[model samples]
Target: MFFHIVLERNMQLHPRHFGRNLRENLVSKLMKDVEGTCSGRHGFVVAITGIENVGKGLIRDGTGFVTFPVKYQCVVFRPFKGEILEAVVTMVNKMGFFAEAGPVQIFVSNHLIPDDMEFQSGDIPNYTTSDGSVKIQKDTEVRLKIIGTRVDATEIFCIGTIKDDFLGVINDPAAV
Candidate 1:
């Protein structure tokens, strides 16, 4: 889920950015540094909303750069167990399929798919029901419930299932 959160960070201002537009420079730098930065605690930092406070700058001994304790509001995306997410299928194989929900990668094993669906092999691999009515393939949007999650320094991986009712393909590109 996406959330608007307040976060704090120490920002270093270079001597070149010490002029009249220091606030603008600081905000731009903050966006460059914090945006796309991922942490185990806060998930993925989406955007910097507003600056709440900027503490007094402390100068370093060797460098003229000033460090300011800045508190800012931002948005983040974090996934949790049992959360239902709509993801686009990226790859399909005999084992199962891989889908992406934003920065998170979700894996739905064959064991987790509905029993009525069977995996078919071809130039365009897919999983389809016996009657060929329901199908999951590349670019298909599926609603899945996350069964497990693991967050790393650079990536978030999730194990998902679509066996339950109302938790399967929401949009089938092939059907279009």
Candidate 2:
């Protein structure tokens, strides 16, 4: 799931950046420092959309840098349990397969796959049905439900399953 929320941060600006165009410099620095960063509470910060408020700068006694309380609107991606998402298969092995949904990495254990599908090992490993109709391999797009989530300070990992109806392979890159 993606969310557009307002967040606050204390941005420190150097004495040299206190002249004209300071606001632009601060905004650019905020984008560089905040974008692509993941927090346990907010998931992954996708983009810094716009600035909401910039509070008065506070100057320290000795340090030449000034700290400003900044509030900004941004977009974030957060996955939750029971959320169905379409992800691209990145790797396949006997144990299971790894898929990526946006910035989140999902692991689908072999047991979570349908019972009718069997794992086949080869130059291009894959899981396929007995009839060879449905195949899940590298670059395959699958619809899976997130069973669990592990949110780290900087990364988000998920356990997913494709055993339910209407879930599983959505697109095969090889078939294209």
Candidate 3:
């Protein structure tokens, strides 16, 4: 899920950025520091939207850098349990397959796949139904329900399942 959230942070500005456009420098730096970074409380920062307020700058004793408390609005992506997501399959093996939904990587184990599908081994490994009508392979877009999720400092991992109805391949590159 994507969220528009307001977050506060202390931004440190270098001496070179003390002139005019300091706010612009600070915002650009904040975007570089916060965007694409995952925080346990705020999830993954997608993009900085707008600045709410910039507090008075406090000068450090030795470094001479100015630290300002800044509140800003940004977009974030956070996945939760039972959330259904469509992701492109990246890899397939006997154990299961790996798919990516933006910055989040989802793993769907063989046990979570429908019983009717069987894993096939070859140059292009895949899982297909007995009739070969339904298939999941690389570049396949699948709708899966997140069973579990873990957020780390740099990455978000999820365990997903497609055993239920309406949760499976939505698009197949092979068909195109």
Candidate 4:
């Protein structure tokens, strides 16, 4: 899921950036430090949309660096258990396949795939139904439900399944 939320952070500004361009430097620094970062609580920060407030700067005694309390509005993506998402397949193997939905990598094991689909091993490995009407291979877009998630301070991994009704291939690259 994508959310627009406000988050607070303490930004440290170097002494060289203390002049008139302080605000611009601070915003740029904040973007560099916060964007593309993942946290257990916030998932991944997609982008820094706007600044809500920048509190008074506090100077450090010895380093001369200033710390400012900053509040900013940003967009974040956090996937939860049972959430349905459409992702493009990146790899396929006997064990299962790996797909990516934005910043999250999802693994759909063979056990979770429908029994009707058999794994075919070849130069172009794939999972196909008995009739061959449906197939899953690299670049195939699939709609899957996340069964489990492992959230770390720097990354988020998900286990998904497409066995349920209406949750399968959305677009087949081979068809195109």
Candidate 5:
């Protein structure tokens, strides 16, 4: 029979692994931490759920690799339903305007705008109401709606509409 030593009973044990009891215990402990950290680290920096291990290419946009158990600092933004909130117009497309409402981002669709309006050729699409009146540009200081999302995750997505009382200006979003 081979000699064996456990040092003390206050230790967790694994089947006699490779060699030393101490070595086996250390490996076992390290393995536990690795597994736990890896599982907990798979998440988005923003609000979200149903996490999947992100691919290297998914976050290769200059953000270095995230080690397991991300150092997360939690902040919450609460928006009430049907409330009119002001935000800076960040992106404007034919479809709508993307704005930053407090901590959350929102989208405002053009259809929501009253009477389609006009901006530099491609700035705002030509919007003519069914009544044949030309739509005014709702493209400045855009007030938007807390519409919908781009994806269905725990992280909330927002949308806006110019048809409502929302307004936006033709400007860069990051400037705000």
Candidate 6:
């Protein structure tokens, strides 16, 4: 059958009745439902499939494991503290700067930005400003420390502090 034709046929039906029908159809197909004599509709699921990224150490998230080779789920978490890692600046915020390394956006806190660098309006990650306008410089690299994390329903945030050498600008011999 054509898609639009099917949609048109459904459109002719009553909205409330259509909704109930759809719900019942889904419950019957996806869930094992029983219309009991007195208990009313009882839903049961002995098993289900095609949930997408579940079971056997595979995480629902697309990212792989932190330790390497062994893959796991991604959530707002800190796998290792004070671990030295390299990252590029993706964004700047009042609270801190977020850098992308692997699948994680590590945070470099405000106090972590070099104290010698002047900031406008006390902005965090203190960007170099000229003529009263703030321009974000791309490709700025910094080492970060895993300090905190904020996990959402779908994404994981690794908050960090750049207050130490391991989290600050790394000495690059090539830059010299």
User: Which one is best on TM-score?
Assistant: 4
lDDT of 3 by residue, 111-130 (tens): 99999999999999999999
For model 5, state the Cα shift of residue 69 in Å: 17
For this target, which candidate reaches the highest lDDT against the unseen true structure? 4
Candidate 6 lDDT, 1-176, residue by residue in tens: 00110000011112333343643443333223211111111111122322222122222244432111111111121234456666787877665677876555677666766554444444334465355343333467766777765554434466776666544654576954
Residue 3's lDDT in candidate 6 = 10
Give the least accurate 10-residue stretch of model 6, judged by summed lDDT. 1-10
Deviation (Å) of 125 in candidate 5:
9.4
lDDT of each: 0.91, 0.95, 0.92, 0.96, 0.42, 0.44
Q: Which is superior by TM-score, 5 or 6?
A: 6
Q: List runs of model 2 lying over 4 Å from the truth.
A: 171-176
lDDT, residue 146, model 1? 95
The predicted structure with the larger lDDT, 1 or 4, is: 4
- TM-score each candidate: 0.91, 0.95, 0.93, 0.95, 0.39, 0.42
Cα deviation in Å at residue 18, candidate 1?
A: 0.7
Q: What tens-digit string does per-residue lDDT give for candidate 4 at 1-176? A: 99999999999999999889999999999999999999989889999999999999999999999999999999999999999989999999999999999999999999999999999999889999999999999999999999999988799999999999989998646756
**Candidate 2 C-alpha lDDT tens digits along 1-176:** 99999999999999988878999999999999999999888999999999999999999889978999999999999999999989999999999999999999999999999999999999999999999999999999999999999988789899999999999998656756
How many pairs collide in each candidate, listed in order? Answer: 0, 0, 0, 0, 26, 0
lDDT of 4: 0.96
Which scores higher on TM-score, 2 or 3? 2
